[model samples]
Target: MIESTTVLVVGGGATGTGIARDLSLRGVDVTLVDRDGLSSGTSGRSHGLLHSGARYAESDRVGAEECIEENTVLRSIAGECIRDTGGLFVQLEEDDPEYFEEKRAACEAIGIETALLDADEARERVPDLTPDVERAMWVPDGAIYPSRLGAANAADAEEHGGTIYPHAPLEAVSVVDGRITEATLGGTVERTIEPEHVVNAAGAWAGQVAALAGVEVTMAPSRGVMVSVAYDELDPVLNRCRDPADGDIVVPHADEAVLGTTSVPVSDPDDYEKAAWEVETSIEECAKLLPPVADAPTVREWWGVRPLYAPDEAEGDRRGISRGYFVLDHADDGVENVTSIVGGKLTTYRQMAETTADHVCESLGVDADCETATRKLPGADDADRLDELVDRYDGQGPTDKDVIAQ
Candidate 1:
């Protein structure tokens, strides 16, 4: 099947979905295509943490502000996707207290609320936390539900005249006159698509997508492993209150706690092996904050890569690189008629989309302003009403209602 669209958005992860939703709401004819179902990539595997901008306080002030702003917007626009589980930055017996103080001060300066909670009070709120917890501070922003956000975006896009092509991987790219004209998808059911403008939002495999279009994108697909402890292990997001390094933060999902993430730089995004060592290391690291979790049963494990990027010509390892999205306008990069929104975090996906859509719209001569932000997405208001969709399917089980993140 061959199709044409005014704007073709590639990748169905957070960034891609956000762009599709924004462009579609602007009344543009948009088509979002992904190799697999939405969040089958990194966005699906991430610890559902709605960052309060504290993690980047010491290093990236700009990112911190952006995190706070987006966190607030998502709470409303994607309300069902988030819970105000109030995050707690725990200070261990040996960890530096000064760092905690600095984090608190920095977050407050940027209008991010932070309150010191005594160890007793902290344990009172979240009884599951280890009693040995020395101290903790409450950050007013933090929550989870990546799958909900992705679904909400897809629904919003559909409501505004957008199409999503899932399980449809791009196989080839055809260019004419230094511009992309057609794209092919592989599988038992093959397909093709032609678009006036294309946005490369592929996460880890972004490089491969760019190559298909005769352009080079140097993206380091660093794999990180996460473990899901099926327990209310922590009441709030438990941060180590230091530089982000290896399995430090434990994010709480619906009925489980997700302790992540060991960064292992990989050569391919398709590689998904949760190494025993990675799992062991994450448990060991999480124990540093709450020893009780050392005995908690791990219900599930997952691995996903962060799509870190650098210049196509230079290489400096993905770990040491800064954390932010890189929006490269193809015209400025000499790749004409294409733009790549690479890197960045789930928290800043909306901003990333707004930026990418601006560039894509410019190329297509579309004057639509971005509305992904400042607008409420579907299911953001109530999860129960959205649950009615399951009934729409003739009494399908809850799990069958939506193939979403658990």
Candidate 2:
């Protein structure tokens, strides 16, 4: 039996769910497939710091602007899923002050407010901050959640009447006469999925997915390792006040804190192992910014792969490549009746969805515009009110406390 749909979103992370929700709300038939549970990839393993665009200020202006814009949008819609703990960037005495100054000015020009805080005041808020830290710039848009963006997007897609297939991997892209027709399930799951517009939102696995389609997607895949700590509050999210390198960020999640991460290009994404030297190196490095982190309880360690896309040879400067999105019309590239959305951040999933949906609609000749922006996702409306309740309540039972809280 061949089932057909308007689109196939090929990842279970923030991006795929967001695209499914967007297309479904536009009155399009959409199916979302994933190789594992929701957020099974880099989305679940991230540092959980909602970017304020400050991280990209010195290096990538376009990426910075997109982050700032999406940061505002997600905060407005996914308020309950977020904790507005705010963010701080600390520059150590040994770190270059000029780069810090450049980041501050770039943020200012891009509408990301950067407030310089006194070292003592910074210490007062984040007591663990190293005394050697000479400067701090606070950005107000920082948010942290126990889990990242997957939940909200998943809930939204389901409520919009979209079908979500977890644990289904794409074995191959089935195309006929230079147009994509469908994708076969990778493993024998006793069921198959046939989607019209197949989206390759597979983060680190994007290049592999493209390979199945007989195309090439070149993303600079980099691996990052993170160390998790139990208990102890750190103010908002603490960043190294420089472009993201290794062990430069401390993101507080739930009752615990996570100190991360080291970035280096890798040939494989599933290489999840901790080098004693690497964790020790991270702890030592984090200690430079936050003295106690050198001694902070080391509860757990994990790694993630970020899908960094370089400009196509057919394209020009990578800096000019829009951070917004790349909606490849499969028809224009040899394959017809298919589209792929790839390379963006979890913070900007909504905008990415809108762009992809517009392109899909154009391909399918649909007239309706996307309504994902206006609708409140399921449980999202309950997010703000259910915060403390869900924190204390069990994941299983129903209680009046939950009802009254919402």
Model 1's alpha-carbon lDDT is 0.77
Q: Which candidate is the best by TM-score?
A: 1
Give per-residue CA lDDT, model 1, range 1-406, as digits (tens): 7888888888888789899999998888998877767766778767667888888876778888988888888876877777788888887777788888888888888888888888898788777676667788888657656666676787788789998776678888898888888888775338788888889999888889988877888887778877877666566788887667787988776667778878777778886666899999998898777676788888777777888886652344456666777888776555588988898888888988998888778777888788776788776777764444222211121211122333
Quote model 2's TM-score. 0.87
Per-candidate TM-score against the hidden true structure: 0.91, 0.87
157 Cα displacement, candidate 2 (Å) = 2.0
lDDT of each: 0.77, 0.69
Give Cα distance to truth, residue 397, candidate 1, Å. 17
How many clashing residue pairs appear in each of the predictions shown? 2, 1
lDDT of 2: 0.69
TM-score quality measure for candidate 1: 0.91
Q: What is the alpha-carbon RMSD of candidate 1 to the true structure? A: 3.4
